[model samples]
Target: MNYHLFKRAAKLFTSLLGTTLLLSGCQSSPESIVEKITPLNPASDVVPVRVVRIDSSYQLQRAGKPYVIKGAAGVQHFEKIKEKGGNSVRLYAPAYADVLMDKAHQNGLTVMFGLWMKPPYEKFDYYDPKAVAEQQQEVYRQVQRYKNHPALLMWNLGNELDNHYGDFKVYQIVNETVKMIHKLDPNHPVTTTITDGVYAIPSIIHLCPDIDVLTVNVFNKLAQQPVRLAEAGWKGPYIIGEFGGRGWWEAPLTSWEAPLDQSSSDKAEFMQAGFKMTVQDQSSRCLGAYVLYWGNRFEQTDMWLSMFAPTGEKTPMVDMIQTLWTGQKPANQAPQVGAIRVANKLAQADLALEPNTDYPASVPATDPDGDPLRVEWKITRDVDEFHTLPQNRTAPETIPGAIREAKGLNAVIRTPTERGGYRLHVNVYDGQGSVSNNSFPFFVGVLDTPRLGIHMPQYRRY
Candidate 1:
């Protein structure tokens, strides 16, 4: 933070906060760190934000007004989100926290800033008081520095910590951190995202009640949240921190055992259904939802859940979300390329091919903008987890060589001479900065089960 920005934030603190008091510094006593960085909640002119109960329902009241979060979870494309009628953005970590806060404020978008917490999965031992206090010291600094920032909506304490986790002691840190935040900044509420509904909600209810609102990153299972929450005995306000298409772990698997990636249109349709079921269906405890991956990145494929592609082209999911938010679509839309088919069969079919043999593959697609589309085909090596290397996991296209012979919508793929598992990828590009992508996973030889070519962040082994 620079001098001018600090001055501007200080001005907002003067107008909104009751008392703009500064802590001495980011110092935490090893013996009692949470005690050292204590909280001070004075009477304020306005309640910056809080989760309020209304009869049998709940909603977010910000500045004395009911606010629903129509949000996206990424750092880029803030201007576009504002145009599409999104009022909030969720940051995953602190790398761009202050910068995104400033940008979000400029765009009139509030932020659900995510405080990156290390769980036992990352070998962060909650049992060790020294380590726990060191982390609290850092958290204290972050809250005190930006607590009065105008764009700060809420603090997401952690993300999905209960997935593949076994430590109950972590909640103590969470509770202590939330306690510190409540004292330092009373304007915004603190939330910790974990595996949703039946799986982790109960533990939070039992172990961590200091969390003001329950935030979840659910997928296709979003519709089941009501039952799951009820079963877990959580009857409070909640927000869909992240939601999109079905994850590859849940998607249909090929005979080779590789998960088939959903088409661009398929993802948009799934997101549309999810948004309707949860946000639009309008559960009493349900606040609005946030569509995910505002920028493009690879999990299953190059463009599995990203709202925008690497070329800065928006996906159809973007259009669907805009429609859901504003009841209107974009002036220009992305190309709707249905599932890529192999041998005139869908990718879901048993896509087993001979080694080094030519196969017929094509993706039927149409551009809504009527921009001439360049359909390019390539061979991607989607290997099992045993063979998944760093390069292949991060950048798939750079491996297994390109199918130079394969061009246009209709193309013949010359398979690799020796392949265990591979994928036929089709990427349709419109000259107008839009792209539609899909992939078909197939085996080289007769194989029943190939390796899983996916990344599970929760169960990462050290």
Candidate 2:
């Protein structure tokens, strides 16, 4: 579990530099911004969902009511998001939009509906008239199918189209599709997402005027957004398309090259700082923010980014989101690993492991709410890459036959044949949907050389 947020503290420096390069100009005064972005629409049975730009500020309104998108990017957990005071969910595709819309509307939440667009790095050619026409037809059909859903807020056109892409024609296609979306669904504004704020360039800003908002999915570089937007010189509104814990791309790597990670609690703490600095800054032009990957999936580690575990249990990151969105923590607290010992030693420097060795470890943990705790252990080889592009997304290689599971609170872990860097990870679940994870990194060295006396051999040489 994440005992603290001290691991990879050096990475925070890089986050600052990234932030400075992205966002620069001071934000407009709240009074001036508020007055500039006030929606012209009066109260009515249904206020059109739209982005209003008064001067330096923009506001999203629905039925003439002010709405800030406390949204998460996930299909599951609509009820949880709403209960946690989030007003929306951002979907990556329309595959389950029909069902999601029905559920989100029932839960008194809106949806930032996403339309999947193929990135140009793939075989799909945006320059081809036939391909573009066929894609536009598909887009039209989907828009026609779901434009009337009450839960629909805005049209998120694509997710990080700039990633691994070289052709600027992609943006041209986006301009075309957004223009089409506006024609078919005027009630909702249209937007597109980039991997980070740095992609919000002047060309994208000027090229797609039909696009209302420049949404960004920022991980550790979140603090750079304001500066990035200012650097882009775009005057339109923006939204945090995806954010939460640090991304696998930017985290520190182990000696063997695996991404060093934060505990669940530490992820929550970094998230708190990120939200406070960017999305929660009311005076800034940020329209709203969406937490990334609401459900669990393997990304570096199972617990690396997902707010929920595979069993639908929430991690401390989830609680942090609840507190940020609702101004209060959840009723249940996650289990905390007070100490993790390898070979009865808590220090990494002291726990020197040898190849083909078996080692004993203990994860002493406690639950704040006194709930029964379940623990799991995992070990993986560290890798050499600190960051990855979209095309290069992958988890570190697992050290096979490495962990021998013990009954409780401990395990007998097997070391790899080759010496390098590896980590012992522990996850503690409180069964109340709260969990904490901790990872202990250790070094593996070669077996010691055998020594023998050579007194007889020296006499023979003479």
Candidate 3:
């Protein structure tokens, strides 16, 4: 009887909560809410897709008009990419194109559809004559299905085809495929992504003259941008198909074994700096760049997702991207820290100073959007000078280090050690990934003299 009653109660509670949520949802504006919750049915709204070249200088026409290609790789979190202000996606070939086209259209994002071909890199035979024919057939099927979709931006013939195998026969096949695609659909441009910008194979370039654009994947060595672009000499629009921090191949020899943690704040700063440098330096020749892996993939330990989780919380880098791309700040603002105070028992002054004392410092943050704010505390020491106590670790190491749904603007951080001077840095990140930082410098002094009346027996004997 008790078990049955509990089950009934649970069902009743769930039903009531569902009804309340439904009612609350109904109160919001219909259009805004519909955009958020609308389900996409691919078959429901398929339209004939057509691409018309605007102008050879389309990018030049839109100069300073925020002509940035804020996109991610298709393998990454697609839905999350759209939610995080990504306007385009780069996905691999024929098998994945249809579904990706539907999703991109639904989210109002563009797709750089990649053609499927495993060049000899992974033990695939591109040299086989029959294999080449089959691959062309696959490409035609994909083009026919998605060519009319509103989301189809451009079609990429292959990814890094020039990396491993140097077979001219493959280039001839690529040329033939491009010719076929042009014959079928002259609306969209066809191009292939290459390994390096500077090392363009003459045979491939001369063979694939029908190819509309040239794409290259560049990494940390963006300083070679000027030289690489000059070397290509394609006289056509180009894209930095892939550009970000060092890939697994580009890491230093000593730290090769140490799996890189791209999620760190330092990495974020490095990416932002590199991006700025590349854009400012190579704007003339570069159309736009796609920051790799908009979502996470396990390859080389999930290097590219701007946010940690796909459907979960965002990382600080997301906020940084928005700032870089849109030049807009988050709706809510970060808090400012005015000052910090420290007290210790040990001091050079006459007053009684204590050792191993606990000192409390107050921190405050604010939000402009009136949204609720949270405070995350962190205390770090200079690795070269002093060793930090167990409590002075990163947020993950400390208990309840990150506080969400916090009521007050101010929070108190406790100091565990009373010894050396330390730098206290506080990071306040809102639920939306907007962050602000504040730091304070403090030192604890040692007591110089003991109580006058209280004397040791050993000292008197001496």
C-alpha lDDT of all candidate models, in order: 0.75, 0.72, 0.53
Model 2, position 371, has a per-residue lDDT of 95
Q: For residues 1-462, could you state the per-residue lDDT of candidate 2 as single tens digits?
A: 353445434334444444344323242122222233322222232337988877777888887777888988887788888888898888888896767778888998888887888877567866555565556666666766667777778888988888766445578678867886787567889999887736436668666778988898887878767876777686668898988888756665333334456777778888888788778874457889999888886666667778888788888888888899989877888876655788887642334488888999887778878999888888886543334344475666666788876766889998887777677878898878788887777768942334221111211100
Superior by TM-score: candidate 1 or candidate 2: 1
lDDT of 1 by residue, 375-440 (tens): 877777784543453246775654444463665788877777776878777788888767888888
- In angstroms, the error of model 2 at 38 is 34
- Tens-digit per-residue lDDT, 1-462, candidate 3: 699878866755664455345435543222332333322323434333332234543242211243446776645567766666777888876565557677787787777788777665557665454455556666766666665566666778888777645544456667777887776555566778877635455766677787766777766666566465666665555666876555544542111121122323434455677667655555654556677656544333322333343334444555556666777755543333233332421112122223334445455455555556665545433121112222343321232332222234344444434454334445555566455443443333543333332222221100
In angstroms, how far off is 117's CA in candidate 2? Answer: 0.9
Stretches > 4 Å off in candidate 2 = 1-47, 337-353, 360-366, 370-372, 380-411, 416-423, 440-462
Indicate the worst ten consecutive residues by lDDT in candidate 1.
15-24
Give the TM-scores of the predictions, in the order they appear: 0.84, 0.78, 0.58
Comparing 1 and 3 by TM-score, which wins? Answer: 1
The regions of model 1 sitting more than 4 angstroms off are 1-47, 383-393, 399-407, 448-462
- Give the candidates in order of lDDT, highest first: 1, 2, 3
